[model samples]
Target: MNDSAAPVPIVPVILCGGSGTRLWPRSRKTRPKPFLPLVGESTLFEATLARCDAAAGFAPPVVVTGAAHLDLVEAQLNGCKGAGTIVEPEGKNTAAAIALAALRLPADAIMLVCPSDHYIADVDTFRETARKAADLAARGWLVTFGITPTGPETGFGYIRRGEAIGVASGWRVDRFVEKPDRARAQAFLDDGGYFWNGGLFAFRAGTFLEELAAHRPALAETVARAVRAGHAEGGRFHPDAQAFAAIQSESVDYAVMENTAKAAVVPASMGWSDIGNWQALHEALEKDGSGNSIAGRAELRDCSNVLVQSDGPRVSVIGASNLIVVVDGDEVLVCTPEGAQDVGKLSGASRQ
Candidate 1:
């Protein structure tokens, strides 16, 4: 195996679903986090497309998103070359989304799965990691990128890297741990084998489908039926609404990765952040000398570790630290960084 040979390009499977409810007010049902330009000039979704451009040994991405976001997804992909989209009738989580992509692509095609709403500050490292993951995938390994943990963060799941797989830059996954308590998270960091599960994966289309069939036959069969009954329209593949809607929803971590023996991980540090909440968004963005991030019509005075974003009004924050203030349309949210996690719970209460 000559490692210096031109490697095959992997198909990018961009999962474009998510309500972004955690960053409520700004992130609404109609306009989710991926479509918002939270950190940079381009929307996160656009940034994702750019990240997997053709020059990086990647095929044009296959975006899996719900019908509700079809227009927005298409709009963002305006100038993107060679990209295809699969429009789901309803959201069925990552398992179904990846199945749809796998079923559409050639069996031997390698798929690079990524969530649409993550922020990666280092593009070069990200591409290098993906390339390594693709190398493992080419050899029939179900590969997931294990982000080197910079801190003991409890919000994301952790992956324990086991013995090396005899590859240059790959390892067998010891185990997948769910989001842990603060104590457990610190233990993982101290033990130095665990990496943050960034939800990025690489595998051959046929390999993943086979593993899915072996682990969750019902889901695999149902999604296959839906894809078979699907049709292409205006560059978008539409899975049969009725059949897809009936398929059971599950995450890939639950359906395949945990159950498969071929699971491998490529560890890398690329400044990844899910941007799950306002606090995370604050941390990902650039901050002023006073440690404040202000967007739109916002003014901060004597503020440290504060984030203020206003889309509809002039927001002024003074003498505040460790706070998140957002004003969008008729809604306003003001909370400490610690309380940002509870913001999504407000959505349910408002409906009640």
Candidate 2:
């Protein structure tokens, strides 16, 4: 290692608390989406940890997850020494989930909040930009990674970037726009100044709480109380269930980022994907000339843009276009790419 001042150690507060409803059948209550290897050999959760290794200037991760998924979290940790897991009694959305992690670290600790199941193809680019975000966070900026939009994707919210701040320090977030219709999304894309909000963020632990207290005081206070009353056993910390459950379910985006004056964004084209549904996963995975990607044994004939993921028996498709078929030993799901968004609504998605 070169003899130089080490970079700030960013504590990666990995928010591992999503049902991944849209990715169901394969993603279920027992082994949600993050724990499954949807994109690559290692699971999305494992890939997330690798992205913030010590070499990348990240501190040990603090994983905030629901109690139901604690076993999966621990099993998948696979000896990531020094990592800590915080178990929430129930699902309370991102705001409370992140607050749980923030409360456990030092007030000055820089927290790099990340969603557990997203796929980032360029790890090097991610690390470089992550450090930049951390520097901005250290300077009291609430930084979010602004992913360069590749298309007019109405499925995600967009971030409007403004004047550059600091020396190569990222741009001021002009405003955040909610998910728009296809036409509006296309208009935003054509304007050439918007980016997809990938839900990745960086801010000091204390800075975050201060803003939360300012914008959502009730939530801030309740989370704090939950932490104070909570207890820890070994590597897992259990927050006061009743106190945590009392807090309203809201995303950090609404609770702070959209309300804070310190919001900044680092634009990155790091091959990012939320892997939100079957269609998105198909796009992320490698495809044959016919536009078909298969994870397990699958045979397709005269198929165009088909995705087949089977963890059990071989799947076969013929004369299909823009389709998604999934088979996970216990369940089977089939739908058109457009119909993929409602996969979670199926009764089987909730089953173990």
**In TM-score terms, which candidate is top?**
1
Off by over 4 Å in 2: 1-7, 350-352
Question: How would you encode candidate 1's per-residue C-alpha lDDT over 1-352 as one tens digit per residue?
Answer: 2244335778889999878888888888788899999988999999998899987778989999988898899999996788899999998999999999999999989899999999999999999999889888888889999999998899999999999977459999989999999999999999999999999999989999999999999999999999999899877999998998889999999999999999999997999999999999999999889888889898788889999898868988788889999988788899998999888899642332
Candidates' C-alpha lDDT: 0.91, 0.90
Q: Which pairs of residues clash in candidate 1, taking residues 3 or more apart in a chain or in different chains?
A: none
Worst 10-residue lDDT window, candidate 1: 1-10
Q: Local error of candidate 2 at 137, Å?
A: 0.5
**Model 1: number of clashes?**
0
Residue 104, candidate 2: Cα error in Å is 1.0
List residue ranges in candidate 1 displaced over 4 A: 1-6, 348-352
Where does candidate 2 have its weakest 10-residue lDDT segment? 1-10
